[model samples]
Structures are given as C-alpha cells and as structure tokens.
Target chain A: MKQSLFEIVSNIQIAENVFKMVLSGDTEAVKKPGQFVNIKIEDGGLFLRRPISVCDCENAGGSGKGTLTIIYKVVGKGTEKMSRMKSGTLDILSGLGNGYDTSLSGEKPLLIGGGVGVPPLYMLAKKLISEGKKVSVILGFNKKSEIFFEDEFKRLGASVKTVTVDGSYGLRGYVTDAMPKDAEGKDGYTYFYTCGPEPMLKAVYKASKTAGQFSFEERMGCGFGACMGCSCRTITGSKRICKEGPVMEKEEILWED
Target chain B: MGRLSVDLCGIELENPIIPASGTFGYGYEFAELYDINILGTFSFKGTTKEERFGNPTPRIAECTAGMINAVGLQNPGVEKVISEELPKLSRCFNKKVMANVSGFSVDDYAYTCERLDSCDQIGWFEVNVSCPNVHGGGMSFGTDPNAAADVTKAVKRVTKKPVIMKLSPNVTDIVSIAKACEDSGADGISLINTLLGMRIDLRTKKPVIANKMGGFSGRAIFPVALRMVYQVSDAVKIPVIGMGGVSSAEDVIEMMLAGASAVEIGAANLVEPYICRDIIEKLPEIMDKYKIDTLKGIIGGAK
Candidate 1:
C-alpha cells in the first residue's frame, strides 16, 4: 500500500539464473509471507513494474528502517535488467496481495515449493516453526545446479527435503514423489502450503491428502485488485490473484483443464 | 492560476482528469490509496446485463511502453453492480460517477443502462460499443457506423443521464462512427479505447495472451489517441473525452489541445497506484510552464 525508494543493499546470483537481493527501506507494509512487491524498472522501454514475492523481512532495530529480501529468476528483459543492477534505489510498491493464512496450519504442517517458488515458503516456514509447530519443507528443482535455499530452510530447524527431476541431486522426480507419510502410513501432513509453477503446483495438489493453501502466479497488470487482468475462476467465484490471493484454499481452487 | 472546472454534457466537474474504466474499479480500491474525491469522476469497470467471467487466464501481455489486456469486460452483472458495488463506492466517492456499460446486443445495452439510470450516484452512461454484436454476425458494434448509431439511440432513450459513446480504435473510419453517434443522440464522446494488438511468446511458441488478441493502451498510444481525439472532436459538436496512454499532467494538456475537454488516465494508474493524484497535483505547475491561463482555453487549440 506504500511506494518508496528502496536501496539495494546487495544483489547476488545464488544459483544459475537465480538471484537473491536484499533491499533496505520501510518494510512495514509487508505483513505476510505470500505478499509481493512491485519493482518499477527505471529502464526507458520497460513501463510495467515487475512483481516479486517477499522472501523475508526484518525491522533493522528501531531506526524506523527495515530490510526486505527477494528472490528472482532472470526470465525476461525486466528480470535481466534487475540482474544487472548493482547498487542504488529501486521504486518499489510494497505489501501487495493476500498472504497465506497460518491459522489453518495445524500441529504438523507441510510446506512445498519449486525453483523460485521456494523463496516465499522460506518466510512461511520460519514463521510456522517459530510458532512451536512441527514444520517439514520439500524443495523442488530441475537439477543440482539450479537448487537454492536448502541450508537456509534447515537453519530454521525444519525437516527439509530436496527433490530433483534428473536424479542429479536429492530424491529423484518432483516434490510430490518425496511427500512424507503419517504413523498409519497414510498422507501424514496435517496441512500443506505450496508455491511454484503451475505444473508443479498441480502435481503437489494431486498428491496432497490434507487441507492446504496454494500460492498462484499470474501475468498481472496492476499488482493490486483494480485491474481484473489476473482473475481466475475458483469454486466460489472468480478472484484476483494479486489482491484476493496469491494464496487460496484447496477446496476453493477450480483448476482449469 | 486558471480555472480547472469542466462541463461535460451540462454536468460540471471539479477538474478535467478522470480515471478510465477498468482501471479505477468502482473508486474504492484507489480510495484506500488516496482520497478519490480529489478526482473529477472515475468510470467504474465495464458492466454487462449478465455476469461475465471474462476471458481465460494469461489475459495480460506487457509491451514496450504499454500493455495489451484481453480481460473481456469481466463484471458481476448490472444488478450486482447497482446493489453491491455502487453501495460500496458511495461510501468513498461523493461525486457523481460514470457508469461504463457493455453488452452483446442492443437490448442488452438498453437493459443494463436502464437499470443503472435509476442509481442516484450515476452521472453519465459510457456505452462501450466495442463489444461484439451477438446478432450482427459477431462483428463489433463500434466498427460499423450503423450499429454504433443504433446502440447510441437505444441507450439514449432509456437513460436520463448523458450518454457518452465509448468508441474503439480498431475501426477504419473513426470519424464516421463518432459523427453517427452524435447524429443518433449521443450527448458526448470518449474516443480511442485500446487499439487491437497482440504479442507472442518466443519460448512457448504461442500467443502470450490466452485470448490471442487484446486491446492495447499506455503511454505508447498517446499520439494515436491525440490524433483520433482531434479528428473526432472536429467531426462532432458534443464534448470529447480523450484517453489512451495518458500518464502525466503534460499529456493532459496535450490531449486538451488535441480537442479533448477532459482526459482519462488508463494504463498509467496500473503502473503507479497514485498516478492520477500525482498528475492532478502537477497540473498547475505545468500550466504555468506552458503559459496557459485556463485549461478550457486549450481545448481544440491545436486545431
């Protein structure tokens, strides 16, 4: 809801074509895990602001300034330009979209993410673990070289598992292949939360046995609710992915065939 | 400083800047950002006789200086708009709001407009003729002068408010359509709704937008919109509301010089949420820079 100039504290390539950036600014607007920030690229040709999720945020003491961490993959001209930026300020619109509802996550929670989607879940895992909840995380990537944030997730004291498609890394196949089972040898997760590309999201959605929340990605116009550009049909009705959610409950999601 | 007030079809406005429909979203969303009462008036999202889910996902494609959207007029139907949406809007906005209506047939337009006419807060009816006519072999109503006139005449009969025909830029003869609307009883005109455009993804080897084609608008389309506004304003005696790629206060003055009595900021609102407020604040300074005594003096000044 607030737009301010955020100074890039550091920007580094964490993995192949993937970057982790730390921004110093007024991070008060970012309230929850799945909410995103819209970065306006100063490049002459690029007019639309790029939306990236908040990986983590902390109020750096009582200086009234906080630091925001975001992870992005160099997908196109905007991200490519973002990758080249070394230092200086970025005009960022912070605190966008409805984040995940942690109240729904019961005693034992399962968190799933793929590739760049892993960033948002990092904050969610950290929050849930701090709440005295047993948290398990499954990180999905294409290969060993593309993997990121496993050690970071582990540092939060959550049981972390890494899955790769080519068998070049941890468990072979997708994140769905590495799901944990309960004491009865059934789907053990009390509740699940996920963020990733559509194919992987669908895979996790099909594999999950408990009530969960899914974070969706869409090509958005206004990273808020004004433009109905990013609306999707749910079981209840159509909702704006940028506003009503980047997160929706499992029962309401009506996946398009 | 000179006067900023404008009279559109006998209705007075505090200023000449109005947020275009689909971008403003009933005024409450932006009202959360800043006081929307500062605006002259805003056009709400396009409403239809029946509820429309709009097009499929991937409805937006970013361009060089603009973007293309195939949102397809997604709305909760006119009844829901009047019952649910307008009540919410009334709490935030005190000014009379423009109601933008779209439909598949003439009766559909009339039915929706007639319903909206009963709403106390509605100041004007912007009939979007860009919708494809269901009865006319799927041709867009705005592309044909006869159909555009027919829609204008039909909506005018049912509404007490001024009927401003919102025209599409996809047509070949823009002036003829504008003139036809004026002749058929359109009280005013708002020109250059998004231009028809598309973008393809090289990696996916398919159209970026699921609808394949969408209406394009942004700062990139400013010159084209100015030219169309100039042409249409000359052809009709009714007031012309120009929109397309208008972002700054300078662009507002330029649109007025090109013959628009007022201008709507469309895509720019998406880029910066507080853009309209920023532009309105910068206008007096820009007016001083250009040595313009009054905003109304510059309407059609270029012509």
Candidate 2:
C-alpha cells in the first residue's frame, strides 16, 4: 500500500445524501476492482481515516498519473465535511483491502449490489466484460430517489436490472427477490459476485445457486491490515476484511444465523 | 548526529521510535511502502501459543482524537510466526525485531517466549500481559501485580533474551504492576497499552464495538501515557519503553524526558501510514528546537 496526496477534482451530490468524488493522484496501488482507499480527514479532532472503495480509476495525465472516483454517503461528521469539499488535496492511502477475484468468474457471471455497494461492482462488471465474459447486474436501492449509476452500469455493456423496496422503480422489492432462478437443462450464471449490507449479503448467500463471491463491510482501522479491527470469522478461520478480503468465496464464509 | 541511538536492555536501537505491536504487521507489510530498515525496530503483531482467530466483526470504534479496538491477539501462533512470518520479516528488515507475545496462561507465555527466543532476528520478548480484547487471558495477567510478576517470571525462566513486560493502563495503580514485573526479573517495561473505553451508537442504542469495550489509543491518551511512564519509571529501575497516543517527534522527546528509554507509536500509524518515517526525519529538528543534543541525556530528565 502507498500513501499519496490526492487532489479532489470535484465532489458532487448525485443522490439524496450520496456523493461522487473524482480524485487525481497516483492510482498505481489500485490493482483490482473491489480495492479501497483510506482517506485522512484534516479536521481538528478526527484522527482515524475513512475507508471508501474505488468506484473507477483511469490514467488521466499520462501512463503513471491517474484519477480515482469514489462514491460516499454523508453518514456522519467525516462524510459531511467531505460533502462540502470542492477542490483540495486529500491524504489518501491507496490500494487497500483485497479486491474482488475476477479470475474466478465463469463464462456467464452475475453481479449484485445495493446502494453505495453498487459502485465497486460497476468496475467489476467492466473488467468481466472486457475479459469476454457475459455479465448481468442487479442493482438494489430503497427508492428511485436513492437510485444511482444504473446508466453507468448499462454503459459498460452489461445487462442491468434495478430493484427498489417501495415499488417506485423497476422490479420492486430487494435484489434477492429479483434473483433469477436456475435453468433446468443449462449451466446458467456459472458464478455470482455480490456487495451490499449484511442482510442483503446473507440473503444472496442463501439464494445463490452456484459458487459465488461475497464482499463484506465492517468498521475498520488502518485499512491496510495493520490493525486487526475488521476481522470476521470464516469456515477456514478469522480473516481481516481489510487484508484477506473485503471479498470472500461463498464456501469460506460462515454466516451467523 | 544527535545521539539518537538508545539502549533498551542490551539491544541498541537506531532511534527511540519503535512502532508498537499490532500496528506494524510483521514489518513486511509496511516495508512495501518504504525502507523499514530505517526504523529503530518494530514490534510484530501479538502472537500466542495457539493460532487465535481473534474477536468478531465491528471490532473498531472511532473517537474524537482516538479509536477503540478489540482486535484481540489475532495471529498465526508461535510455530507459524517462527516458520512463516519471521522469514518474510527477515527479508525486509535487517534489524533485530521485537516479538510481542500474548497468552492465556503462565505456561502459555513461557512456551511462546521460549520458542520465539530461538529466532536470531528477535531482539527482545515483549510479553503482552495487557491486551483488553481477550476474555480469560491477556489483560487478566496484567491487571494484578502478582499475576503480572508471575507471567514475567515464567517467561524470563524460559528465555535468555531481554523481557519487557508490556503493562495495561486500565489499572488503578499501574506503578505497582510495573514494580512487580521488575522485581520478578523483567529486563525492561513498556506502558501504557490502550486504555479500556467504549462508545454507543445513538440510533441503535447499542455499543459500536461488538466486544462492547476496547482499548482506546491515539493523541487523546498521550498525557495519560506520559504520566504513567513517569510514575512507573520512577518506581522501577528497569528501562521503561513509554507508549500510548505518541504520534510526533516532540511527543517522543517528551516521553523520553518522562523516563522512557524508547517510545512506541500506535494509532497514529493507522491515520498516517508514513508517520513513523516522518517522525524519524523530524526528530533532529525537534531536538534542535528543544536545545537537546542527545536523546539518552533526556531519559528521566523530567524526574
């Protein structure tokens, strides 16, 4: 992992309390799709850095120079301060947490995400499609007002479907409710990848027909894995969500009932 | 040179800034960012006799100027640490590293320390009797003077390396525990480990950390650390390694002045990944500002 100063190109409110921030910095550390960046807030009293996943990254100025995009919600004081920031340098710890393992994706892969979790899967879907893999995406949000990145996901050439809890948009109910059933005679959706809240993740884990990968969210410290603050018990053993994974295989995760 | 070198027990450190255990994972992780050989030495993650899975999720809680963590002692155990972790650490760091050992029992402490002593790269055995995350072990051995001395004596009997008993700050009288360890043949002392603290989620009306409480550390705990270091260093003749909420070069000098031979940086490293390196580079400038030429000259100077 590397720490560098990122210049905030823009911070815009896309949804109700959600924001989309584009940053310019050394993006070399971000190798995988689900990897995150730990942002250090320069406020008076906040000492801990806030962890946010990489929404997208591209080499902007040249081969070594690039810009990173991240989506965050104004959950507390840190993000509230972040929402007000227009243009400034942010001290960012890049290439944090083990990202999604795209190599495990089969020919036909299904991607599922909810709310803020939708951003990481956008990059994942893009990478999977680039590899000549057929990709399908399911986006879940509370309502139409909270919906975001639907066109962004569709622009990447993946078949996108959105689900809302209030029936205010397409395919009302949760993402799990919109999950496609297994076809009888053919190998449908050889593998699945999902990122969302704990309930959604657990539902996806139970509803998935094939071997899949699940991304977990936990309150973290030192997002690079120094502090064992985000550890979760798995079938193998306890794994740090920041180190071993923000992503884990379906078989390895032991969900608490 | 402004005499940055420090003698902890018999081992010499290039500087007094050692990254506290659990914050610097086996040294190799941080070495990927910078040349870790520039450090005095770092204490690797807390290890135990058996591989521990550590506590459950939501183990961290952020505070005003600090963070609380109940990471427990998540490690690959002593055998794996010796066979796997240390070899990777040796590749990046050429200096003698400190081994931080935690256990559930006196024999557990002795067994783990004795095994770690065989590693040539290990300079000192930092017995962690002050971890608050674990239930039956860790802080249980540290909270009481007799238990702290018992663990210290047990580990000292099994190993020939310098033994520094890491003390917890959650106690009423931390000096008594430090003296007890020193009286039981502890080569040195390191304090204060994270203070026990907690936070509640107002919406859910529940504790933020799954463990309900965790050890709190950061800039907020610096004064508490300095006071404990002063009290403990005065009470014991053994070299004291002061820590807790130490983030800057000035804090390092102040800790040394308060009677610490060395200081460990914990939560600050989490906030700024390059903090230790930055502090090391800034130490001389801070030393010049304070009109101090030698760091060792300031040890216990405040006392």
Candidate 3:
C-alpha cells in the first residue's frame, strides 16, 4: 500500500446522500480494478480512516502519479465530514484490498451492483470492456432519487440495466430479476461479478447461473489486514475482508446465516 | 546506542516507539509501507493456546476521538504464528519482536508463552490480561489482584524473557493489579490495555459492536493511560511500557515523562499507518525542542 496526500479535485453530490469525489494523487500502488483506498478525513472527533473503493482511476503510467475517483455515501461522521470538504489534501492509503480478478471473466461477463457497492463495479466494468469481453451490468437502487451512474456504465460500452425496488425507474424489482438464466446460450453470461448489500448478494448468489465473484463489505479497522477486525469465516478458514479480499470467488464463499 | 534508544528489559531498542499488539499485526503488514526496523520493537497479534476466530462481525465501532473493538484476541493459534506468521515477519523485520499472548485460562497463557519463547526473535512476552471483549477469560484475570498475579506467576515459570503483564484500565485499582503482577515476578508492566467501552447505533437501537462492548482506545485515552502509567510506574519498580491511544512524538515524550520506559502507538497506526516511523523521526526534533538530552533521563520526570 502507498500512503500519499491526495488533492481533492472535485466533490459533488450525485444522488440522495451519495457523493462523487475526484482526488489527484500517486495512484501507482493501485494494482487491480476493485482495490480500495483508506482515506483519513482530518476531523477532531474521528480517529480511524474511512475505507472507500476506487470507483475509477487514470494512471500516469510509470510516473507514479494519477487521479482517483471514489463514490461514498455520507453514512457517518467521517463520510459526513468528507462530503463537506471542497478542497484540501487527504492522507490516503491507496491500493488496498485484493481487487477483482478479471482473468476469470471468460467472454460474456455480467456485473451486478447495489447502492454504494456500485462504485467498484464501475472500474471493473471498464477493465472488462477494455479486454474486448462483452459486459452486461445491472445497477440496483431503492428509489429513483437514490439512483446513480446509470449512464456512466452505458458510456463504458457495457449493456446497462437499472433496477429500482420502488418501481420509480427502469425494471421494478432487483438486480437478480435481470439475470439471464441460460449459461450455455450465445447471449448467456460466461461469468458474473456482484457487489451489494448482504441480502442482495445472497439473492444474486442463489440466482446466478455461472461461477462468479462477489465483493464484500465489513466494518474495518486497518483496511490493510493487520487488525483482524474485519475477519470472516471462509471455506478454507478465516480471512480478513480488507486483505484476503474485498473480492472472493463464488465457489469459495461460505455465507453466514 | 543512539539517543532514541532505551533499554527494554536489558535488550536495547533503537527507539521508544513500539507499536502496540493487535495494531501492528505480525510486523510485515506495515513493512509493505516502510521498513519496520525503524520501530523499537512491536508486539505481534494476541495469540492463544487454541486458534480463536474471535468475536463476530461488526467487531469495530467508531466513537468520538477513538474506536471500540471487540476483536477478542483472534489469531492463528500459537503453532501457526510460529510456523506461518514469524517466518513471514522474519523476512522484513530484522530486530527482535515482542510477543503478545492472551488466553482464556492461566495455563493457556503459560502454554502459548512457553511455545513462543522458543522462537529466537521474541525479545519479551507481553501477557495480555486486559481484553474486555472476551466472555470469561481475558479481562477477568486483570480486574482482580490475585488472578493477575496468578497468571503472571504461571507464565514467568516457562519463559526467561522479560514478562510484561498487560493490565486493563477497567479495574477499581489498576495500581494494585500492577503491584500484584510485579510482586509475583513480572519483569515489567504495560498499561493501559484499553478502557471498557460500548457504542449504540442510533438507527438499529442496538450495540454497534456485535459483541455489544469492546476495548476502547485512541487519542481520547492518552491522558487516562498516562495517569495510569504514572500510578503503576510509581507503584512498581519494573519498567513500564505505556500505550492506549498514543499517536504522536509529543505523546511519546509525554508518556516517558509520566514514567513509561517505552510507549506503544496503538490506534494511531490504524489512522496514520506511518505513525511509528513518523514518531521515531520526529522524536529527536521534539526532544530538542523540549531541551531533553536523553529519553532515558525523562522517564518519570513529570513525577
């Protein structure tokens, strides 16, 4: 992981309580699409750094400098403080967590995301499309006002399907309601990747047709795996959600009841 | 040795900035960010006789100027730590490492400490008797003087290394516990582990941590830690390793002046990641500003 000061390029509210923040920093340490960054919001009351996934990135090649785009919901005091800031350098620990493995995406890959989980999938979708694979995305939101990045995924050359629970916009169910059933068909997805609330992830896990990957969320201490505060039981043993994964393959996931 | 160096149980540290147990992991995790040899010596993760998965999810809860964690001494057991963690740590860290052992029983503490004592890299065995998250074992031994002494005497029997009894601050008399351990042959003392604390989620109306309560530490606990360090250091003759929310070079110097021979950076490492290295680099500058020549001279200066 690389600790660097990221200059806030832009901070704007995109959806209801959701924000898009652009930071210019040394992005050389970020290796994969779904990897995260732990940002320290300099607030008097806050002690722990907030871990946010890299929504998108522009690498400076070998120069070791770049721009990072992160989307976060103002959930607590830390993110609430982050949203109020328009400028200033943020001490960020970049290139954290084991990101998604794009190599496992065969030909036609399906991406499913819910709420704040949609941010990481944006970069994952970008990587998959750039690799010449056919990408299909299903974005989920609670209501019309809560929806975000619907057009951004479409602009990345991925077939986008926006789902809302309230029937406020697009399909009137969930991301699982949009999954194509046949895995062997020409249009069927060869693999699937998902990130969302635990209930949504569980629904998608049961509804998925192909072996895929899922990104997880946990209350983390050190987003770099040292604290063991975010550890969860996997089939193999215990793994830190920040280190061994923010992403795990479908076969390896042993979801808790 | 350099001016930053201080004697920690006969083994001299390059500096007084030791990263506390649970915060530093096996040492190699932070080694990915910078050379960890710059630290005096860090206490590794809390290990037990049996491998513990620890408390359930939502083990961490954020508070004002601190965090409450019910991690409950999750580890790969003593065997895996020796076979897996140590070998990985030995690659990046060249200096001796402090081993922090926690247990559900007095025998469990002895077993884990005895097993880890065989490792050559271990400089001190920090026996944790102050974990508040666990059910019956951890903080139970620390709240009482006799139980604290019992665990200390049992662990001291197996290891020749300096046994630092890590005391919890949740007790009525922290000094009594420290004195008990010292009287029972504890080579040194380390306090305060963490203040027993809890946080309630406003939305859920339930505890933020799944375990309901956790050990709280951060910048907020520094004064309480310093006060306890003063009291414990004054009560006991052995070296005192002070921790609990230590973040800066100023805090380290403050801890030493309050009677700590060495200070451990806890939650600050989670916030800064480079805090130990930053504190070590800044110690000399801070010292020069304070007109202090040697860190060893400042021990208990405030007293």
Instruction: Give the winner by TM-score: 2 or 3.
Output: 3
- Candidate 2 regions exceeding 4 Å error are A60-62, A183-188
Instruction: Report the number of the highest-lDDT candidate.
Output: 3
lDDT tens readout by residue for model 3, B1-303: 788889998999889989999998888889988999888999999999888999999999888899999999898899999999999999999999999999999999999999999999999999999999898898999999999999999999999999999999998899999999999999999999989899999999999999898999999998899999999999899999999888889999999999999999899888788889888999899999999999998999998
Docking model 2 quality class: high
Interface RMSD computed for candidate 3 is what? 0.7
Error of 2 at B246 (Å): 0.6
The DockQ of each candidate is 0.87, 0.81, 0.88
Whole-model lDDT per candidate: 0.90, 0.91, 0.92
Q: Give the higher-lDDT candidate: 2 or 3.
A: 3
Candidate ranking (TM-score, best to worst): 3, 1, 2
Candidate 2 chain B, run of 10 with poorest lDDT: B1-10
Off by over 4 Å in 3: A60-62
Can you give the lDDT of residue B3 in candidate 2?
78
After superposition on all CA atoms, what RMSD does each candidate show versus the true structure? 1.9, 1.9, 1.2
Ranking the candidates on lDDT from highest down gives 3, 2, 1
Better of 1 and 2 by DockQ: 1
The residue-by-residue lDDT of candidate 1 on B1-303, one tens digit each, is 237878888988888999999898888999999999999899899999899888887999999999998888889999999999999998999999999998888898899999999999999998898742122311388899999899999998998799999998877889999999999999999987898889999999999999898888898999999999999999899999999999899999999999999899999999899999998899989999989888988899998
